[model samples]
Target: MDFIFFDADGRYFNFLCLYQILYKPVILTIFSAMQTMRWAFMLCTISQLDVLIYNFENMKELVKAGNCEINEAFKDGFKKNIVHHCAIIQFVNTIGRAFGGQILLFFMINSFIICTTAVQFFSIPNPLNNIMELVWIFGFLFIMIIMLYIDCYFGTIITEKGSQISMTVYCFPWIDLKQDLKKQFIIFFVRNQQDLVINASKLIPVSMTTFRKVMNWTYKGFAVLNQMRK
Candidate 1:
């Protein structure tokens, strides 16, 4: 029930009243923007997971096929799976962001609610009332920065390292734990991966034209995606 600048004007008026009047719409606008961000993250997560599952399934099938039948594209696919697995880590990181942002949003909404009630005690407020505002506004920002950094940088590294384990542990229950299919899958995957390396080894003397074409295709795809993001 603390307040600030309650001196003159018979102390009937409170600064918080003006503050709320001016701040509510702005806070609501930010809340709306956060909702949009949340939705976008959800859709983005779904899209990434869908692509990952699709590509992983396709690559798994290619690996299940014998090496003699594997093609260069399928070899590229094996490489792509590693990248996709890495991407899954990133998508999971996005989940952390989505969750953390919602937490922040809750804090924001709570702050707004506090603002509404804050003036109620203005009549019997202490001289330190203004300090409450500064504490919430500034302290909350500091907490948010730490939250985002920890979730993005620190959590990503941990999750990326754990991703292989997560893939195995989490999916083991769904997969047939029998010996036959397990042996077949490992043998098939390893044989194909090694064969791909062997095939690639033989093609190390790639033609300059093929190398340039690959470089061009990669650059073009990167540019397109970058542009789309922009």
Candidate 2:
């Protein structure tokens, strides 16, 4: 235990030897798991959206040839598709809900970490003494920002593709459909109009907008801290 808990000469080395080895690795693992889960959800959502879009394209192809008669089988298949899509959407939402609180906490803690690291890096006068500390802070800052960017980018993709599904439905020849089928299509379109947007704790929608906001906020906060330090 003494050997594992021993401190090094440099601050960064000490941190790496103690917290990094004992605690940071665990924290990183958890974050990695969350990130992987998020990526998986986004991919699944996109792939399912692709499937729906393909179905819509096929329907469009059928209707393009003046064949407006939608068979009973097609109607049934459409209904099943609706259910499948809703399930996928709901699953993502559930994932968001389950992890949203943790995500918020993660962002808050990371922000603090970045702030303190920046302060230490910029405030310290002796560069030789704290070179490792500078490198450590910079590395973490870069990695965290990159991770956030990927998260928001993928989230944006999910929403955009989900919204396009409704548009795909609209592209179909609805006017020529039988009255009952037309009614069903109308209902489906209306349902899809809601679109799929997974929010973090219902506060921040996980999209590029959030990414920009976070970056701006971090920068402003860092600037303020820097001024306070001076």
Give a tens-digit lDDT track for model 2, residues 1-230.
Answer: 34544456655676566655667678879868877887787787788888878877776666566565455434755777788787878887886888678666766766667666777678878888988877887888788777777778887888898888888778776776678888888998887787577778888888898888877777788899899888
Clashing pairs in 1: none
lDDT assessment of candidate 1: 0.44
- lDDT values of the candidates? 0.44, 0.76
Q: Give the per-residue lDDT digits (tens) of candidate 1, residues 65-134.
A: 6442334434455456556655655664555544554544443444343333333323233647577765
The alpha-carbon deviation from the true structure for residue 197 of candidate 2, after best TM-score superposition, in angstroms, is: 0.9
Q: Supply the global lDDT for candidate 2.
A: 0.76
**TM-score: model 1 vs. ground truth:** 0.34
Q: Kindly provide the TM-score of model 2 when superposed on the true structure, using C-alpha atoms.
A: 0.79
Q: What ranges in model 1 sit over 4 Å off?
A: 1-22, 59-68, 71-74, 94-230
